[model samples]
Target: MSDAASTGFSADWLRQREPFDLAARSASLALGFRAALGPQNPAAFRIVDLASGSGANFRALAPLLEKDQEWRLVDHDPLLLAAQRSEITRWASGQRWHCHDHEGGLAIHAGPARWLVRSQQLDLARDLEDIDLASCDGLVTTAFLDLVSAAWLDRLSALLVRTPRPLLASLTVDGRRTWFPTRPADQLIADAFLSHQGGEKGFGPSLGVRATPYLAAHLAVAGYQVSTQSSDWHIGREHSDMLLNMAQEAATVATETDPSCKPAVSSWLADRAADIHHGLLSLEIGHLDLLAVPHFPVVK
Candidate 1:
C-alpha cells in the first residue's frame, strides 16, 4: 500500500471533512456510549481512539462524554499525530477552554470538565494488540472501519470480547450515494466508487460498505448489544467545495476502475461541475454510527 493509504489520511482532507463528520454523527449513540461507561472517577475516564486522524474524533466526542476525559489518540502517521496538539489547542482556544501541555500531552479545561489527550503513533494493522483496551473506559473510531479487512475486524471482536468495553464507531460508509438533479451517470459513478472502495487500503481487501454490518453481527454474536443509526452527510449547494471534491474523486476512481468509462466519467464530471457552479448540486452520502456495549444492566 502507498504511504498515504498506509499512514492514513492527510491533515487537510481530515480538516475539510471534520465539520461534516461532526454534524453527521449520532449524538444519541454517543451519549449512550457515555452511559455505558458507568460511573467512574470524574478525573479518570479514559478512551482509546483508533486511527485518530488529527484528533477530530476526540474533539467531536469529548464534550459529549464525561466531564473528565483522557484520550489516547492512536494512528500510524507521525505527522498527523504531531499535528494533534496544535489542532487541539486551536480548537480549545476557540471554545474558550484553557489548553496547555501536561505530562507530554495536552490538558484542556472546559468549564468544570478536564480532558487530557495523548497521541500515540502506532500502525494499527500491526500494533492493535499493543493497545491496552482494558484500561480504557471505551473505544471510539470515526471514518475508519470501512478500510479494515474481515480478519482485522475478527481480531478486534475477539479483543473486545476478551476485555469488554463500549465501542462507538461512527461515520462508516454504507454504500449509498445520492446526487441531486439526478443523472443516469450517477449510478455508474456510484458503482465505480464502491468498487474502488474495496481495494486494498493497508488491510488486505477492505470490507468497504460491508464493514458496519459485519462488525455489528460479530459483536452481537459475542453477546454485545449493538445499535446503529444513520449518520448520512447531506451536502447542499452551499458546500460547493466539498461537492467539487467529491465529483473529482469519483471521476478519478471511476476512470481508474475501468479505462473504458473515462469518456463517460469526463462528461459526468463536466455536468457536475456545471451544476455546482450554478448552485444546483446537492448530495447525500450514507453512513452508519454503531454503538456496541456488553449486555449489562441498563444505566439510567
Candidate 2:
C-alpha cells in the first residue's frame, strides 16, 4: 500500500515502486513539458517536487527532461529528506552518470544532460505559499494527492494563481485495487482501506479517490488547462514482497475499522498469502496522473 497510514513508507516500498511509477507515468506529459519549456528557453529548467519521497520523482523525470535542470525536493519527513542524497547518488551510479557532490546539491551529467538535485525538509501545509513558485519553471509530485485535504488543494490553487507553471502530478491512487481470482472478503477489506485513506495524513479529511477531480477543478479555476491519464500499478505474482505488504496493510486497516472483522480478515490474508506464494495472486491498483498547464495571458 502506498498510503502511509497503514504500511507507510519504507525503503523497501519506495525501492519496489520506483520503476513502476516511472513506467506508468504519462509519457505524453513529458512531451507537453518539453513543448511548454520550448526550444527558446534552453538555459535552465527549475522544478520543485512536493512531498518528495526519497527522490523517486526526480529519478523518473530527470532523464526524460533533456536539459540543464535544477530540482528542489520537499517533504515533511526529515528522515526521508536525509535519504535523498544517498538515494540519488546510488541511482546515478546505476545509470552511469558522471556524478559529483556539489555544495548546494548533487551535480550529475548523463550524456548531454546535466542535473542538480537539492533536498528541503518543510511542512508543506504551513509553507506551501512560502515556496518560491514564481522562480520555478514547473512543479511535480507523485503518489501524494490522496493524502491531502480540499483546503490544502485550495491553498495550492491560490499559490498557482500567483505564478502559473506546468505541474505534473502522478501516481495518485484512484480507489481501485483488484486482487486476482477474487476473494470473498475483498470488498470489505478494500472499503475499510479506502476509509483509512480519507482519515488524515497530517492534512484534514484527505480526499483519497476524490482528490484528482477537486485538484483539477481548482487548477481550471486558476486558469490552468488540466488533463489526466491513468497511471495504475499492475502487480503480478512475481513481485511477492509488495503484494504481501499490500495484503498486510489491507488487513491492518480492515481490522482497525471493525475489530470484529479480525477473523474474516485473517482468513483473507492467509488465502492471499498462499496465492502470492504460489505465484497465483495479481493486483491492479487504480491511479491517475494529472497535467496542468497555466494559460499565460497573451500579450497584445
Candidate 3:
C-alpha cells in the first residue's frame, strides 16, 4: 500500500462512534469563538474545514453561526465529501450553497450558489498553489494532525502565517486511552495493542507519546497561539460490544507484529468478548481536544 493508504485512517472505524461523541465536545470550544470575536458580530461568516468527514464539525458549527454563513467544506475522500454535501443539503435546505470538487477532493459551496468539486489532495506541508488564501476569513479542522509528520506541519504553519485568516483547529489525540476505564489486565493488553499498532507506521517507535505535544510545538513554532481542552467518552457495560470490536482490531495489530504478544492479547480479548456477551465489561475512551490559531500577520 502507498503511503497515503497506509497512513490514511478511516473515519468509518468511528462507526461504533465513541470518537464522534468525543468530537462533538469540540463544538463548545468552537462556540467560544464568539467571546473572542465579540457579541455584536454579524451572522454572516465564511469558514473552511479541511479533511471534513461526514461534516461532524460542520453540523456542530452550523447552529452556532448565522444561517447565512458561507461554509466551504474540503476533504480528500470522495465518499466523505458526498456525505457532507448531502448532510448540508438536508439540514439547511437550499439556503446554503455547496461546491463539490470531487477530482481534488475540494468543495467550495456557499448559500444558494453553485459548487465545484476539485479532486486533489492538498498536502499541508506543501505550498497551496491553487487555493486563494485571501478569500477565506476563518479556518477549521477536527480530529486531524496525528496522521501528519513534523515536516508536514511546518509547511502548514508557514502557509497559515502567510494567510490572513485566523485558524480554529481541533485535534483529538488518544492521550489516556491506555489508562481509561478498564481493568489492569485489559489495560495491559490495550497498551500492547496500541504499541503494536504504532509500529505499523514507519515512525511507529516514537509516536506513542509524540502526537499531541508535537503538534502544539509545531504550531507554536509557526507562531500560532494554542490552547487545549480534554474530553472523555465513558461507556458502560451496555456498550462493551462495540468496545470489544475496537479492542479486537487493536489486538489483531499487536498479535501480528509481536508473536510473543499474541497469546496474552488473544486470551485477554477472548475474555473481554465473553464479558461483553454476558454484559460484564465497561469501557471508556479518552481524547484531548486542542484549539490552535495561526498568527495572522497584520496587513500593513
The most accurate candidate by lDDT is 1
Q: Write the per-residue lDDT of candidate 3 for residues 128-216, one digit (tens) a residue.
A: 34455566556677666555555555555666677745556664446455423455566555555456434433322334335567666
By lDDT, rank the candidates, best first. Answer: 1, 2, 3
For all candidates in order, the CA lDDT equals 0.88, 0.84, 0.55
Q: RMSD per prediction, one decimal?
A: 2.7, 1.9, 5.3
Is 2 or 3 the stronger prediction by TM-score?
A: 2
Q: What is the lDDT of residue 67 in candidate 3?
A: 39
Q: Where is model 2 poorest over a 10-residue stretch in terms of lDDT?
A: 1-10
User: Please, what are the lDDT tens digits per residue for candidate 1 over residues 182-214?
Assistant: 999999998888887888888778899999999
TM-score of each: 0.95, 0.95, 0.73
lDDT, candidate 1, at 211: 97
Q: Candidate 3: where is the Cα deviation over 4 Å?
A: 1-15, 22-28, 34-43, 88-131, 178-188, 193-209, 294-300
lDDT of 2 at 6: 48
Which is the better candidate, 1 or 3, if ranked by TM-score? 1
Summarize candidate 2's per-residue lDDT along 143-256 as a digit string, tens digits.
Answer: 888888999989888878877778888988899989997998999988998888788777788898989988998898778889998988888888898889888878888988
lDDT minimum window of 10 residues, candidate 3: 1-10
